[model samples]
Target chain A: AQTVTQSQPEMSVQEAETVTLSCTYDTSESDYYLFWYKQPPSRQMILVIRQEAYKQQNATENRFSVNFQKAAKSFSLKISDSQLGDAAMYFCAYKIPGNQFYFGTGTSLTVIP
Target chain B: DAGVTQSPTHLIKTRGQQVTLRCSPKSGHDTVSWYQQALGQGPQFIFQYYEEEERQRGNFPDRFSGHQFPNYSSELNVNALLLGDSALYLCASSLLEGRNSPLHFGNGTRLTVT
Candidate 1:
């Protein structure tokens, strides 16, 4: 079974600052995908970024990027120039090609203004 | 395009009662998956349906069952519900083709079993 672990329960970042949320997973499969999802108070889970395990290069989407270290089984999300709107619960997820997704406990982010 | 949508945004049920949650897949999507997210916890996969059949399921017991309609809409049925069954139920839709196809999620239905 694959399991994702998010060590941080809560995180805070000042406006215009940057913050990195850490995540690690245990999986023996060589082919997989990693993702970061954001859920605001509205309760909608939005995709932030995703990384393919086979790709050595990291994935970035606007201010959101992922530092994916396949060898270490570590996938972290970095939010650059954070804004108040970034305040939400972030979850790290892992998925195999055709299997169910495994998600971390999540980290509540507070964007300090 | 209309994303995945779930009905009864909020539902309250008592112990031993049965409840049903519905989900409509996103436009052009043929696969639907259901998840349960407890308070302060991550979402746990309940099951996935494709071609109107269950393709994968999590560790949930037989008390949790589901069905997928011809239109790719799905329904999750929980019987003999317990207080621990109270959680936010999310419905996600995605293409069943490739590995990296991302899942489109609905706002989720909050289920409260008292």
Candidate 2:
């Protein structure tokens, strides 16, 4: 079974600052995918970023980037220049090829203006 | 293009009652997946439908069942629902052929069992 773990329950960052959310996972599969999803108060789950296990290079989308250390099974999300709109519940997820996704408990992020 | 869309944005039902939720996949998407998100928690996969059949399921009870139509739309039906079933149900869609295709999610249907 694959399990994703997000250690941070809640995080806060000042506007224009940076914050990193830690995530680790346990999986037997060699090839899989990792993802970060953000859910705002509106209740829509939006894809923040994704990383492929085989790719050594990390994935970054705008201000959102991931530090994917495959050997250590660590995938942490880094938000640079955080904005107020970034305030949401961020979830770490793992998925194998052609399988369902395993998600962590989620970390609530509050961007203080 | 329209993203994944779910019907009845919010629903309230009594315990032991039955409820059905509908989902329309995004354009060019061939797969539909259902997930349950409890309060202050991440989404948990319930099942996935492809080719009008169930391809994968998670650790959910038989009381939860689903169907997919030829057009790739799907329906999730919960029978004899329990209070624990009160949560947000999210529908996501993606292309089956793309190994790394990311899921496009709907706004989700908030189901409350009283």
Candidate 3:
């Protein structure tokens, strides 16, 4: 079974600064997908960004990017120019060819103004 | 376009009871997946429904069941609920054809068991 781990339970970043949330997973599948999801206090889960294991180049979307190290089974999310809106529970997820999705314990991100 | 939508934003049930939560998939989506997010933990996959059939399931027990309609809407049913079942239930929809289809999630139903 695949499992995702987010070591940091809580993180804080000053406004306009950058922050990185660490994530690691255990999976034997050669090809898979990694994703970072943000769940605000309202309880709505929103997709931040995603990375494909086969892609060597890290995926970036605006201020959100991922540092994906397939060999180390590490996929970290980086948020630049952090804003107050970034405060939420961030989760790292893993999925393979199958349909099931495995998620990490989550990291609560607090944007300090 | 409308994203995934779930019904009964909140619910309360007692032990030995049954609860049913509904979900409407996003436009043009044909697959619906259900997840249970316990407090302080991540969302755990319950099952995935495609073509009105259960295409895949996780390690959840048989007490957890679901149904998918022809319109791609889905429902998650839990029987003999326990206090452990108190959590947020999320519904996600995605395209089945894409190798890496991103799941659009709903606001989720907060279930409270007593």
Pick by DockQ: 1 or 3, better one: 1
- Residue runs of model 1 more than 4 Å from their true location after superposition: none
Candidate number with the higher TM-score (1 or 2): 1
Instruction: State the lDDT of candidate 2 residue by residue for A20-98, as single tens digits.
Output: 9999999989999999999999998899999999999999999999999999999999999999999999999998888
Q: Which stretches of candidate 2 lie over 4 Å from their true place?
A: none
Model 3: residue B8 alpha-carbon error in angstroms: 0.5
Candidate 2 Cα deviation (angstroms), residue B20: 0.4
**Candidate 2 chain A — worst ten consecutive residues by lDDT sum?**
A93-102
**CAPRI class assigned to model 3:** high
Off by over 4 Å in 3: none
DockQ of each: 0.91, 0.86, 0.83
Write the residue-wise lDDT of candidate 3 on A17-102 in tens digits: 99999999999899899999999999999999999899999999999999998899999999999999999999999988656789
Tens digit of per-residue lDDT, candidate 1, span B1-114: 888999999999999999999999999998999999999999999999999999999999999999999999999999999999999999999999967988899999999999
For model 2, what share of native contacts is present? 0.86
Strongest candidate by TM-score: 1
